[model samples]
Target: MIPHAALQTAADRFGTPLYVYDASELDAALGRVRSAFGGAQVYYAMKANPNLTLLRRMHAAGVGFECVSGGEIARAEEVGASGDRVLVNGPAKLPGEYAAGARLGATFVVDREEEVGLLPPGSRALVRVNPALAVSTHDHLATGAAGSKFGVTPAQAPGVLRALRDAGHTALGLHVHIGSAIRDAADFSAAFARLAELHPAVSDLDVLDVGGGWGVGADLPGIAREARAAASVFGAELWVEPGRYLVAQAGTLLTRVVGQKRTGRPFLLTDAGMTELLRPMLYGAEHPVTALWEGEPAGTWDVAGPACESGDLLARDVLLPAPVPGGLLAIGEAGAYGASMSSTYLTRPRPAEALWEGGEWRPIRRRETPQDVWAMEQGLE
Candidate 1:
């Protein structure tokens, strides 16, 4: 967690509607993963927060990348990760994406049976197995649940692996990513069980990737035990992809109270909206909001953004101090998908991002200007 004072300082230095990340928290998260799963390869899922500076930090720490698109692969390559250091994963990969992966000799994850023929000749690959179990996460986050359009069924994984080998590609083994922000470790246990059952049909596997979706404060040691047990079925190497688990708590979104509203419920209007942070509106995610101004507890309040849309609320029913126009409010747990998912909808420029390292605040991404937003649409001639 970033210190409240640091968040306020960042807001003052960078301006409100800013994102602040703590380098110490990022390192600590990686340390936790390394300690929990000893000897297992760790891949930072780049989709969570693909800031180039952050990528370089992960690369310096000797962590690999799990990328889902050609652009993401390029980001990984920007930091000198290629070949075995990159794991390419996506259900519907495009032709250009395949070319990008081929150039780097990246390890492709075959999500569907038909993907077997799409790989470059002599490519190394893993078959993604959808255990098809019910997981306790939001519907949009449950990528491995039944009817989810993610991976091949567990029964289809063996055939896909064989097809990869027959097509002259190196068949690494099986991969299973049940979902994101999965709280129930039992969900992972069941998914691993389904993969272990395939050992009889899928033998001599080299890797068993249990894709990361561990919730904050999840029992990682217990989950690692189950993962190791499943990997032992084929004596394969254990690999994990951690995304939000490593960054969620390390980020803070700083926005200012612009005014107050009294529509049926009390609301504190803010300068930032869905364009700055979309998780609260998109996934019903509730981020803890901290008021910077000192005041006695006013009462429960809803935080609204500049958007006219009623669904643009950042937080609801938050017990907060009385609103002071221009008072700062820090939205917590935004390190993962906050800026990565930000958009320019309604022509609102994206917010700036900064990093707190070595007791100093440094700008990582500058705030966009209105001119910058419209530059692409202007005629170059």
Candidate 2:
């Protein structure tokens, strides 16, 4: 674990409702992934957290970038990631986004047949094959399973490839993203084996892009090992687009306790809630919660945010030291989907983001203000 002092110091300097990331931790995580898959290309899924500081660090570490939209493509360029080192993936791509990606020379723009005609002349491409692999995770996150609207179904891919071939577009690879937070490596191996059967028919298969959804601390080393085992089977030049596994553990959400009350169950109200981090309230996702200060241990408490809705809970039946109003709390494993998924619900301002390194804290993003929220309203005058 990163030293808690770093988090406390960051909170002291940046204030509460802050996201603190440890650069050293990120480097170590990237190193582990590289070592496990010897010579494979690891692309940082920019959708997770697009903080420029994080993007620069990942780029400097020899990591590539994966973009799902034109905005992400621009961000990748801003951080010095060239198009040759970037792979554009998404089921939906607007004509402008596809044209922009083509103009930038993105390594490969993955297609799902829906946007095949949008491919720029003489550009290289990859067909994303939805093998209908079952992934164990939240229903909202499962993308590769049968009947999903994500990638091209196995039955649709061959036709798409043939059409692309006839159109003179270079089909250089195949891509697949099973789902998010996958726990089993066997699932990946099975999927790869199914894709391998199609390899013989694919021309000039220079890359096998495996969409990244490597599970993080919810399962720990178990999922990490599975990722490694799965990567070993695909001896081709492999590419992985992992977002959560790399940054999740390197983050913490520090929120101040607003009040303590007891109803049917003890409740700890925090100033930061669904507006700042929506994974819990939006998907009922689990994140470990703890008090920042040392104190006598207390029993179960329902940890909730300031949102008016009863569904705005971070955790329930959570054991922690009794916290006083104004006390600090840290929500662990928040680096990935936390801030990126934040919203302006209930008109609350978004939280700030910070970077922790060498005992110093640097503000990466400013906390949003009420004026910032209303600035876009045309009739606010």
Candidate closest to the true structure, highest lDDT: 1
Candidate 2 wrong stretches, greater than 4 Å = 217-235, 378-381
**lDDT of each residue in 144-180, candidate 2, tens digit only:** 7886777776667667877777778887667888888
Per-prediction TM-score: 0.98, 0.92
Q: How would you encode candidate 1's per-residue C-alpha lDDT over 55-94 as one tens digit per residue? A: 9999999899999998999998899998888999999999
Candidate 2 similarity to native, TM-score: 0.92
Candidate 1 error regions (>4 Å) = none
Q: Top model by TM-score, which number? A: 1
How does model 1 fare in lDDT?
A: 0.91
CA lDDT of every candidate: 0.91, 0.78
